[model samples]
Target: MSSPEPRAPRYLVRRWGQLLLGLLLYGIAISLMIRADIGLDPWTVFAQGVARQSGWSIGIVTIVVGAIVLLLWIPLKQRPGIGTVLNVLLVGLALDLGLAFVRTPEELWARILLFAGGLALLALATGLYLGARFGPGPRDGLMTGAHARFGWAIWKVRTGVEVTVLAIGWMLGGTVGVGTVAFALLIGPMVHWTVPRLRVPAAGDPPRPARRRSARAQAAPA
Candidate 1:
């Protein structure tokens, strides 16, 4: 007689949970930064620019942007996992929900606090999702795909892409301010610190190679 069906591995379930939670938190963090209205990271600036021009909400723009980026993955021979797909769908919805509930503050101190909280939350979320190892987000996948396709250094690819987007975003009237500088300065180190600590261990996991983001600014997945 056939035995009862085997259950899914607990770690698989845990990984899925972590991915979802991380994406949700990432969206909320983005919303917080937007409400702070001081500045935003590069991709968010791009989203804001598109949102401004298209008259769509930033969350909607985010989803559209993610989908578009995913399409670009095809030519680069990038394959996506369920985590990547969900990252595209879920983060934007969460961002909109978060924006609905969170309000902007009038005081400079309060705005600074909000941006700081958002940045911290964003860093934590990046660790959780990436540590799950389901897949890279669309933006990150693009950078890696370009590196592999062209044999460019990861840092060079990242810088070129971000600078291009930053230029377009600025031209499209997205906010560019101190927060943008702060994000560029801080996110790499923060992600480097958090990812190692938060990464989940699996039975057959391979040893990850050491990366030197300190020497080169390695932006986390947007």
Candidate 2:
């Protein structure tokens, strides 16, 4: 009889589990922040704006926006991996689920807890998903693709796109404040702290080179 095929390495299984957890946490983080009501992050502000204009739920708008952004990847020849697909579907579902359970708190301290907790969770979520190395999300792809195709600096591309989105979303009445600024300033450090520690090495993967966030402002956390 032919020898049994070698089993897949254990780390692969762990990686998949981590990926799911990360995505779930990401969705929860978004819900917590929105419910916190202190502010909406930039991409989220865009989703809120579009939700207002289209009358769709924020989760639905988020999914639609992700899909549209994914389509843009075609011209750049960027491909979505398993992580990419999951990020699109799961984060929105989690957001809606979180919203269902979490009501807007009446007390200021409660809101503060939600905001601070959400920020930390979002950073951890970023590390889990990106470190899994399945692929970047639709929004991340948009930033990277623009930089590659246009030969613009990563920060310049990321900043221009995000600022424009923020403006449009703000105009549409998306809440903005301390949360927005905090997310903008702190996420890089947060992701920096978390990504390196949790990253799953490839099966037989070589010594890892430094991994950089292709865009300065990812703005893609759940």
In terms of TM-score, the best-performing candidate is 1
lDDT of each: 0.91, 0.87
On the 0 to 100 scale, the lDDT of residue 117 in model 2 is 94
Per-candidate TM-score against the hidden true structure: 0.87, 0.86
lDDT of 2 by residue, 89-196 (tens): 889888888889999899999998999999999999989998888888888988888888878888988898899999999999788898899889988998999998
lDDT, candidate 1, 104-172, per-residue tens? 999989999999999999999999999888898999999999999989999998999899888899899
